[model samples]
Target: MASRSTLLKLTFVVAMVLAVVVLPPPADAAISCSQVLGYLRPCIGYVTGSVPGKVPPAVCCTGIKSLNSAAKVTPDRQAVCRCLKQLANGFGSGPVNRAGAVPGKCGVNIPFKISLSTDCSKVR
Candidate 1:
């Protein structure tokens, strides 16, 4: 009985040690890739849209390059594209609007604006 009790205690100690070694760090312990991505999302919209004026928001540019490094097609890229299209559409183009005007016909269809432009400059 004494030997069995000693063995059980030893096994419990080993299990605790293994648990401590194997467990992941706590959520607050460090910054993770997902957290970085989350921070970048809003910046994407601002940069792509040329917010507050013609000059792009500096924060937006910083996050986008970091996001691009991680993935070929990032969530940030999509957000920025959508924002630019929406901004362009706000300008409202005309029928046969050849002079770098956004297609007013799209109205709320931000996706359609991108299809019309080779680059955003053409739409703006």
Candidate 2:
């Protein structure tokens, strides 16, 4: 008993709703280790203990939190782990060890250990 115009409007509304429901969500941008490193670089002095008695700054903890969130995917996590390992190797053992402790110090619980010799391939 509906008029043609009303039926057409109803059909259009239903179609629009269905399309919205059926369409796949937009994909998230891929995270890269370089991006993660960029965030962490500001915290280097604190992490490496280069500045004696210096605790990590607020920016450092913010960067740590961002990296932790970004590396949620397995691939991103592994990439970050490898990058961290390479970065650790560039410093000597003492600094590298200190660097590994940054995440915990910042209260970020990354899944894998951060070490110069960490096997990134084993990170999950």
Candidate 3:
């Protein structure tokens, strides 16, 4: 039977410990669509800069597929590709979007105008 104040203090301390010890997403965890979108945000500038040019490097595509299989093979793959294509075309760089275009790590090849761009900076 702890007092209310004591129980509250204990709760707070436990919460603080959990906050410090609890981990974020694993390095190899599957990323949600929203997370993927966030990761690709900054790369927009980098990609748009190269509009009307060759697509982004294969490394970019490889990295994306490696990070999230959903980005490449899942039924949502097309949505991801389409979203990226729109972003590339809108940004005026057909190439950067192409950089993200490629088969997913699971071997699902996305066939569209160009592949999506992948920026891993958001992944911790």
Candidate 4:
């Protein structure tokens, strides 16, 4: 049987694909890609396995919680969704599963999955 961490990792990978399918947003995006990336960068080490642990670091959780709080409305949420989708596109499966596990590990509940077929249009 798979370890708990492995199971969680697989679940997140599927969610990441939900984000993967986010279409390009309008020119007047509520959130910028830069902003989304900034909030997420701190978690990269944990998600990518550079950090040696199953739990995400405090800084990583803080960023995820902050991002969760920051995107208050549908437009902002969708903007974030799109940005996340863009992020997943550049990474391979290993990182995606790792990244997927971060939000849950940090105690944040994402409103939607982040997989390629997630249909960001329905994120709200």
Candidate 5:
């Protein structure tokens, strides 16, 4: 006894529900690449050896610490790793890809290596 319009509306609703349930979740649902890059910007100069310093500056360390804290989950860590790899690739053959030392010098421990060869899929 349902009217045609009522049945169409019901079908639409059901289809929407099915789509929501069937679709895979977003890859970086928890973390964003922009966020990962934003947190590491302060350390870029020090990390790339473009700036003269025996150690990373306090601001650089602070940024690294914040990045480390934000990447607590596996997905977030993987996102960070991916972002670092992307940045490294953009840097060409320059030494700007020396991000691995920043974390250690800054005393912040990241869950994954920042090297270009680091397998982000295995970050967990």
Candidate 6:
């Protein structure tokens, strides 16, 4: 017969193996920037000033609202702010200024300014 200590060690090892195999992997704690961008893509025309009207469409506001809702945590909010800054850089100053104004125009209360100069790391 196995010694008590030996049996205990074997039981611990089996339990650990079982836990690894049976338990699901932990879910990601933060949302990806790509996902946030996907939601905001529809607002590009309005944000860029490419569209004739200054007013953003209802769909654009919906997307902004959805993005606002998803970025609940500090990390997620920071990620979103970084992504927006990147997008602003890609859009150039003219469009970026307009883009920054989009949230307020749509009545969406964003935590950080969506400007190219925004320091995303400092976003709360």
What's the count of clashing pairs in each model shown? 0, 0, 3, 12, 0, 0
Instruction: Name the TM-score of candidate 2.
Output: 0.70
Candidate 3 versus the native: TM-score?
A: 0.35
Write the candidate numbers in order of decreasing TM-score.
6, 4, 5, 2, 3, 1
Spell out the clash pairs found in candidate 3. Answer: 51-93, 100-116, 101-115
Alpha carbon deviation, residue 118, candidate 4 (Å) = 1.6
lDDT of 6 by residue, 1-124 (tens): 9999999999999999999999999854776878887889889988777766868888888999999998898888988987887777777788888888888988999999878778888888
Q: List model 4 lDDT by residue over 66-101, tens digit each.
A: 999988788888888888888888888787777877
Candidate 3 per-residue lDDT over residues 70-121, each given as its tens digit: 4544444545544555555544444453344333322445444353344332
> Which sections of candidate 6 miss by over 4 Å?
1-10, 13-28
Error of 5 at 108 (Å): 1.3
Off by over 4 Å in 1: 1-4, 14-37, 44-55, 65-124
Q: What is the TM-score of candidate 6?
A: 0.77
The best candidate by TM-score is 6
Clashing pairs in 5: none
Cα lDDT computed for each candidate against the true fold: 0.44, 0.81, 0.50, 0.83, 0.81, 0.85
Candidate 1 vs candidate 6, TM-score winner: 6
Write one digit per residue (lDDT tens) for candidate 1, span 42-124: 54343344444433345544554454343333343344444444444554443213212222221212222343363533331
lDDT of 2 by residue, 11-43 (tens): 999999999999998765556767978989878
lDDT of 4: 0.83
Residues 15-55, candidate 5: write the lDDT tens digits: 99999999987766757778977887787787677887878
lDDT of 3: 0.50
